[model samples]
Target: MKLFVFDLDFTIWNAGGTWCDSTHPPFAWKEGKLKDQENRWIYLYPEVKEILSELKAEGHMIAIASRTNAPTIAKQLLHMFEIDHFFDAREIYPGSKLTHFDRIMKELKVAKNDIVFFDDEYRNVEDIRSIGIESVLVTNGLTKDLVKPYLTRTIARDLPQSEAC
Candidate 1:
Protein backbone atom coordinates (compact mmCIF):
# COMPACT_ATOMS: atom_id res chain seq x y z
CA MET A 1 0.00 0.00 0.00
CA LYS A 2 1.16 3.54 -0.66
CA LEU A 3 1.61 5.67 2.44
CA PHE A 4 1.01 9.43 2.21
CA VAL A 5 2.80 11.50 4.81
CA PHE A 6 2.34 15.26 5.23
CA ASP A 7 3.91 18.05 7.22
CA LEU A 8 1.68 19.95 9.62
CA ASP A 9 2.21 23.70 9.96
CA PHE A 10 2.50 25.34 6.57
CA THR A 11 1.53 22.25 4.64
CA ILE A 12 -1.75 21.50 6.40
CA TRP A 13 -2.80 24.80 7.89
CA ASN A 14 -2.00 28.49 7.78
CA ALA A 15 -0.50 29.38 11.13
CA GLY A 16 0.02 32.95 10.00
CA GLY A 17 3.85 32.81 9.93
CA THR A 18 3.93 32.20 13.66
CA TRP A 19 3.66 28.72 15.02
CA CYS A 20 2.16 27.95 18.40
CA ASP A 21 4.68 29.18 20.95
CA SER A 22 4.67 28.76 24.73
CA THR A 23 2.78 31.99 25.25
CA HIS A 24 0.28 31.11 22.55
CA PRO A 25 -0.94 28.05 24.46
CA PRO A 26 -2.91 25.23 22.84
CA PHE A 27 -5.44 25.93 20.17
CA ALA A 28 -9.15 25.75 20.80
CA TRP A 29 -12.06 25.34 18.46
CA LYS A 30 -14.18 28.42 19.05
CA GLU A 31 -16.97 29.80 16.87
CA GLY A 32 -15.79 27.65 13.94
CA LYS A 33 -12.24 28.93 14.13
CA LEU A 34 -9.10 27.43 15.54
CA LYS A 35 -7.56 29.97 17.87
CA ASP A 36 -4.63 29.98 20.23
CA GLN A 37 -4.38 31.66 23.59
CA GLU A 38 -4.07 35.08 22.00
CA ASN A 39 -6.98 34.44 19.60
CA ARG A 40 -4.74 34.00 16.55
CA TRP A 41 -6.66 32.01 13.95
CA ILE A 42 -5.31 29.02 12.11
CA TYR A 43 -7.06 27.70 9.06
CA LEU A 44 -6.64 24.86 6.61
CA TYR A 45 -5.72 25.73 3.10
CA PRO A 46 -8.12 25.28 0.22
CA GLU A 47 -8.83 21.72 -0.91
CA VAL A 48 -6.83 20.17 1.92
CA LYS A 49 -9.76 18.32 3.48
CA GLU A 50 -11.20 17.23 0.17
CA ILE A 51 -7.85 15.96 -1.09
CA LEU A 52 -7.18 14.06 2.11
CA SER A 53 -10.67 12.58 2.09
CA GLU A 54 -10.21 11.50 -1.50
CA LEU A 55 -6.93 9.83 -0.70
CA LYS A 56 -8.47 7.99 2.22
CA ALA A 57 -11.45 6.91 0.15
CA GLU A 58 -9.01 5.53 -2.42
CA GLY A 59 -7.54 3.28 0.31
CA HIS A 60 -4.26 5.09 0.72
CA MET A 61 -2.86 5.14 4.26
CA ILE A 62 -2.34 8.63 5.58
CA ALA A 63 0.26 9.85 8.09
CA ILE A 64 1.85 13.00 9.49
CA ALA A 65 5.48 14.12 9.87
CA SER A 66 5.77 17.56 11.35
CA ARG A 67 8.68 19.59 12.73
CA THR A 68 6.50 21.85 14.80
CA ASN A 69 7.78 22.60 18.27
CA ALA A 70 4.24 22.79 19.59
CA PRO A 71 3.04 19.29 19.01
CA THR A 72 0.26 19.62 21.56
CA ILE A 73 -1.17 22.56 19.72
CA ALA A 74 -0.80 20.77 16.43
CA LYS A 75 -2.61 17.69 17.67
CA GLN A 76 -5.33 19.81 19.19
CA LEU A 77 -5.81 21.62 15.93
CA LEU A 78 -5.98 18.35 14.05
CA HIS A 79 -8.56 17.07 16.44
CA MET A 80 -10.50 20.30 16.30
CA PHE A 81 -10.60 20.15 12.53
CA GLU A 82 -11.81 16.53 12.74
CA ILE A 83 -9.22 15.27 10.25
CA ASP A 84 -6.99 13.48 12.71
CA HIS A 85 -8.78 10.20 12.16
CA PHE A 86 -7.64 10.16 8.55
CA PHE A 87 -4.08 9.49 9.64
CA ASP A 88 -3.03 5.93 10.40
CA ALA A 89 0.38 6.96 11.64
CA ARG A 90 2.07 10.15 12.80
CA GLU A 91 5.55 11.37 13.74
CA ILE A 92 4.91 14.91 14.82
CA TYR A 93 7.72 16.67 16.65
CA PRO A 94 10.71 18.96 16.24
CA GLY A 95 13.37 17.00 14.40
CA SER A 96 14.82 16.15 11.04
CA LYS A 97 12.42 14.98 8.35
CA LEU A 98 14.60 11.95 7.84
CA THR A 99 14.06 10.82 11.41
CA HIS A 100 10.33 11.29 11.10
CA PHE A 101 10.23 9.24 7.88
CA ASP A 102 12.39 6.51 9.37
CA ARG A 103 10.08 6.11 12.33
CA ILE A 104 6.98 6.21 10.12
CA MET A 105 8.40 3.60 7.77
CA LYS A 106 9.15 1.26 10.65
CA GLU A 107 5.80 1.75 12.34
CA LEU A 108 3.91 1.14 9.12
CA LYS A 109 6.28 -1.59 7.96
CA VAL A 110 6.41 0.01 4.56
CA ALA A 111 9.38 0.33 2.28
CA LYS A 112 10.86 3.72 1.49
CA ASN A 113 9.79 3.45 -2.14
CA ASP A 114 6.16 2.90 -1.19
CA ILE A 115 5.94 6.21 0.64
CA VAL A 116 5.09 9.67 -0.74
CA PHE A 117 5.89 12.63 1.47
CA PHE A 118 4.60 16.20 1.17
CA ASP A 119 6.00 19.29 2.86
CA ASP A 120 6.07 23.03 2.20
CA GLU A 121 9.76 23.30 2.97
CA TYR A 122 12.26 22.54 0.22
CA ARG A 123 14.85 21.41 2.72
CA ASN A 124 12.50 18.83 4.20
CA VAL A 125 11.57 17.60 0.74
CA GLU A 126 15.19 17.22 -0.29
CA ASP A 127 16.13 15.54 2.95
CA ILE A 128 13.32 13.02 2.72
CA ARG A 129 13.99 12.35 -0.98
CA SER A 130 17.64 11.60 -0.24
CA ILE A 131 16.49 8.48 1.63
CA GLY A 132 14.76 6.96 -1.45
CA ILE A 133 11.22 8.10 -0.73
CA GLU A 134 9.25 10.09 -3.27
CA SER A 135 8.80 13.62 -1.88
CA VAL A 136 6.81 16.58 -3.14
CA LEU A 137 7.47 20.20 -2.19
CA VAL A 138 4.04 21.70 -1.64
CA THR A 139 4.66 25.40 -2.00
CA ASN A 140 0.96 26.21 -2.33
CA GLY A 141 -0.16 23.55 0.09
CA LEU A 142 -1.99 20.29 -0.65
CA THR A 143 -4.31 20.17 -3.61
CA LYS A 144 -5.99 17.44 -5.64
CA ASP A 145 -3.95 18.23 -8.74
CA LEU A 146 -0.70 18.10 -6.82
CA VAL A 147 -1.44 14.72 -5.17
CA LYS A 148 -3.28 12.99 -8.02
CA PRO A 149 -0.19 12.23 -10.10
CA TYR A 150 1.53 10.44 -7.24
CA LEU A 151 -1.54 8.33 -6.54
CA THR A 152 -1.80 7.19 -10.16
CA ARG A 153 1.93 6.70 -10.67
CA THR A 154 2.41 4.56 -7.60
CA ILE A 155 2.22 1.10 -9.16
CA ALA A 156 4.10 1.91 -12.35
CA ARG A 157 7.01 3.58 -10.59
CA ASP A 158 7.38 0.79 -8.08
CA LEU A 159 7.70 -1.83 -10.83
CA PRO A 160 11.03 -2.88 -12.27
CA GLN A 161 11.77 -0.85 -15.41
CA SER A 162 12.12 -3.93 -17.59
CA GLU A 163 8.93 -5.50 -16.32
CA ALA A 164 6.95 -2.27 -16.45
CA CYS A 165 7.25 -2.14 -20.22
Candidate 2:
Protein backbone atom coordinates (compact mmCIF):
# COMPACT_ATOMS: atom_id res chain seq x y z
CA MET A 1 0.00 0.00 0.00
CA LYS A 2 1.13 3.55 -0.74
CA LEU A 3 1.47 6.23 1.91
CA PHE A 4 -0.06 9.59 0.99
CA VAL A 5 1.80 12.57 2.43
CA PHE A 6 0.70 16.22 2.40
CA ASP A 7 2.31 19.46 3.47
CA LEU A 8 0.41 21.24 6.23
CA ASP A 9 0.48 24.95 5.45
CA PHE A 10 -0.99 25.19 2.02
CA THR A 11 -1.70 21.60 1.15
CA ILE A 12 -3.88 20.92 4.18
CA TRP A 13 -5.09 24.26 5.47
CA ASN A 14 -4.64 27.91 4.48
CA ALA A 15 -3.76 28.67 8.15
CA GLY A 16 -5.27 32.17 8.12
CA GLY A 17 -3.67 33.26 4.85
CA THR A 18 -0.24 32.46 6.25
CA TRP A 19 1.80 29.71 7.79
CA CYS A 20 0.68 28.14 11.05
CA ASP A 21 3.82 29.37 12.78
CA SER A 22 2.91 32.90 11.77
CA THR A 23 -0.66 32.78 12.94
CA HIS A 24 -1.77 34.45 16.17
CA PRO A 25 -1.83 32.35 19.30
CA PRO A 26 -4.71 31.05 21.48
CA PHE A 27 -6.55 29.51 18.58
CA ALA A 28 -10.09 28.39 19.12
CA TRP A 29 -13.00 26.79 17.36
CA LYS A 30 -15.42 29.64 16.88
CA GLU A 31 -18.73 29.05 15.13
CA GLY A 32 -17.52 26.17 12.97
CA LYS A 33 -14.35 28.05 12.05
CA LEU A 34 -10.90 28.20 13.61
CA LYS A 35 -9.80 31.75 14.38
CA ASP A 36 -6.84 33.08 16.29
CA GLN A 37 -6.40 36.02 18.64
CA GLU A 38 -6.21 38.50 15.79
CA ASN A 39 -9.38 37.01 14.34
CA ARG A 40 -7.58 35.70 11.30
CA TRP A 41 -9.46 32.66 10.13
CA ILE A 42 -7.60 29.42 9.57
CA TYR A 43 -9.44 26.88 7.54
CA LEU A 44 -8.93 23.77 5.47
CA TYR A 45 -9.17 23.94 1.72
CA PRO A 46 -12.59 23.15 0.31
CA GLU A 47 -11.78 19.68 -0.83
CA VAL A 48 -9.36 18.75 1.95
CA LYS A 49 -11.78 16.83 4.13
CA GLU A 50 -13.39 15.13 1.17
CA ILE A 51 -10.07 14.10 -0.27
CA LEU A 52 -8.80 12.84 3.07
CA SER A 53 -11.96 10.90 3.73
CA GLU A 54 -11.85 9.27 0.34
CA LEU A 55 -8.24 8.28 0.76
CA LYS A 56 -8.93 6.78 4.18
CA ALA A 57 -11.97 4.92 2.88
CA GLU A 58 -9.86 3.46 0.10
CA GLY A 59 -7.65 1.94 2.86
CA HIS A 60 -4.61 4.09 2.19
CA MET A 61 -2.20 5.32 4.82
CA ILE A 62 -2.00 9.09 5.26
CA ALA A 63 0.90 11.13 6.58
CA ILE A 64 1.93 14.75 7.14
CA ALA A 65 5.25 16.39 6.24
CA SER A 66 5.36 20.01 7.36
CA ARG A 67 8.30 22.39 7.67
CA THR A 68 6.75 24.75 10.15
CA ASN A 69 8.99 26.35 12.74
CA ALA A 70 6.44 25.70 15.46
CA PRO A 71 5.80 22.01 15.46
CA THR A 72 3.73 22.30 18.62
CA ILE A 73 1.53 24.94 17.12
CA ALA A 74 1.14 22.93 13.98
CA LYS A 75 0.11 19.87 15.91
CA GLN A 76 -2.23 21.97 18.03
CA LEU A 77 -3.87 23.35 14.94
CA LEU A 78 -4.27 19.89 13.53
CA HIS A 79 -5.88 18.68 16.73
CA MET A 80 -8.11 21.72 17.00
CA PHE A 81 -9.18 21.28 13.43
CA GLU A 82 -10.17 17.75 14.44
CA ILE A 83 -8.05 16.23 11.70
CA ASP A 84 -5.03 15.17 13.69
CA HIS A 85 -6.42 11.68 13.93
CA PHE A 86 -6.26 11.32 10.19
CA PHE A 87 -2.49 11.38 9.91
CA ASP A 88 -0.87 8.03 10.66
CA ALA A 89 2.52 9.75 10.78
CA ARG A 90 3.56 13.39 11.26
CA GLU A 91 6.90 15.08 10.58
CA ILE A 92 6.27 18.73 11.31
CA TYR A 93 9.59 20.31 12.11
CA PRO A 94 11.45 22.90 10.05
CA GLY A 95 14.25 21.04 8.33
CA SER A 96 15.19 19.32 5.16
CA LYS A 97 12.29 17.77 3.32
CA LEU A 98 14.65 14.86 2.84
CA THR A 99 14.86 14.30 6.57
CA HIS A 100 11.12 14.43 6.93
CA PHE A 101 10.66 11.77 4.29
CA ASP A 102 13.50 9.76 5.71
CA ARG A 103 11.88 9.59 9.14
CA ILE A 104 8.57 8.74 7.54
CA MET A 105 10.19 6.05 5.43
CA LYS A 106 11.85 4.53 8.48
CA GLU A 107 8.72 4.81 10.57
CA LEU A 108 6.35 3.40 7.99
CA LYS A 109 8.82 0.96 6.51
CA VAL A 110 7.75 2.06 3.05
CA ALA A 111 10.02 2.55 0.09
CA LYS A 112 10.50 5.99 -1.39
CA ASN A 113 8.39 5.02 -4.38
CA ASP A 114 5.67 3.86 -1.99
CA ILE A 115 5.02 7.46 -1.03
CA VAL A 116 2.91 10.01 -2.89
CA PHE A 117 3.79 13.47 -1.62
CA PHE A 118 2.03 16.78 -2.20
CA ASP A 119 3.35 20.23 -1.41
CA ASP A 120 2.76 23.84 -2.46
CA GLU A 121 6.45 24.72 -2.57
CA TYR A 122 8.25 23.93 -5.79
CA ARG A 123 11.45 23.30 -3.88
CA ASN A 124 9.77 20.74 -1.68
CA VAL A 125 8.25 18.93 -4.61
CA GLU A 126 11.63 18.80 -6.30
CA ASP A 127 13.32 17.74 -3.09
CA ILE A 128 10.97 14.85 -2.50
CA ARG A 129 10.99 13.94 -6.16
CA SER A 130 14.77 13.80 -6.14
CA ILE A 131 14.53 10.91 -3.68
CA GLY A 132 12.47 9.01 -6.26
CA ILE A 133 9.08 9.62 -4.64
CA GLU A 134 5.99 10.31 -6.67
CA SER A 135 5.49 13.98 -5.80
CA VAL A 136 2.83 16.40 -6.95
CA LEU A 137 2.81 20.18 -6.75
CA VAL A 138 -0.26 21.66 -5.16
CA THR A 139 -0.68 25.07 -6.76
CA ASN A 140 -3.54 27.09 -5.24
CA GLY A 141 -4.83 24.45 -2.85
CA LEU A 142 -5.47 20.74 -2.80
CA THR A 143 -8.48 19.61 -4.76
CA LYS A 144 -10.08 16.30 -5.49
CA ASP A 145 -9.21 16.50 -9.14
CA LEU A 146 -5.58 17.46 -8.49
CA VAL A 147 -5.13 14.51 -6.12
CA LYS A 148 -7.56 12.05 -7.66
CA PRO A 149 -5.55 11.31 -10.75
CA TYR A 150 -2.39 10.55 -8.81
CA LEU A 151 -4.18 8.60 -6.08
CA THR A 152 -6.26 6.60 -8.50
CA ARG A 153 -3.45 5.89 -10.92
CA THR A 154 -1.22 4.56 -8.18
CA ILE A 155 -3.51 2.40 -6.03
CA ALA A 156 -6.41 1.25 -8.19
CA ARG A 157 -4.67 -1.97 -9.02
CA ASP A 158 -4.39 -2.93 -5.35
CA LEU A 159 -7.92 -1.94 -4.44
CA PRO A 160 -10.94 -4.14 -4.77
CA GLN A 161 -12.76 -1.38 -6.73
CA SER A 162 -10.94 1.92 -6.68
CA GLU A 163 -13.13 4.92 -7.15
CA ALA A 164 -12.95 6.58 -10.57
CA CYS A 165 -11.20 9.86 -10.74
TM-score of each: 0.85, 0.90
lDDT of all predictions, in order shown?
0.82, 0.87
lDDT of residue 49 for candidate 2: 86
lDDT of 2 by residue, 8-107 (tens): 9988899878998988878988898889999999999998888888888878889999999999989888888788888889998999899999998899
The true-versus-predicted C-alpha distance at residue 36 of model 2, in Å, is: 0.2
Clashing pairs in 1: none
Q: Could you give candidate 1's per-residue lDDT for residues 1-165 as a string of tens digits? A: 589999987788887566544427566778887777788888898898988887887788999999888788788778878899999998888979888888888898988878898898999999988888899988876777778787655557778999999
Each candidate structure's count of clashing pairs = 0, 0
Which 10-residue span in candidate 2 carries the lowest summed lDDT?
Answer: 156-165
Candidate 1 has a TM-score of 0.85
List where candidate 2 sits over 4 angstroms from the true fold.
153-165
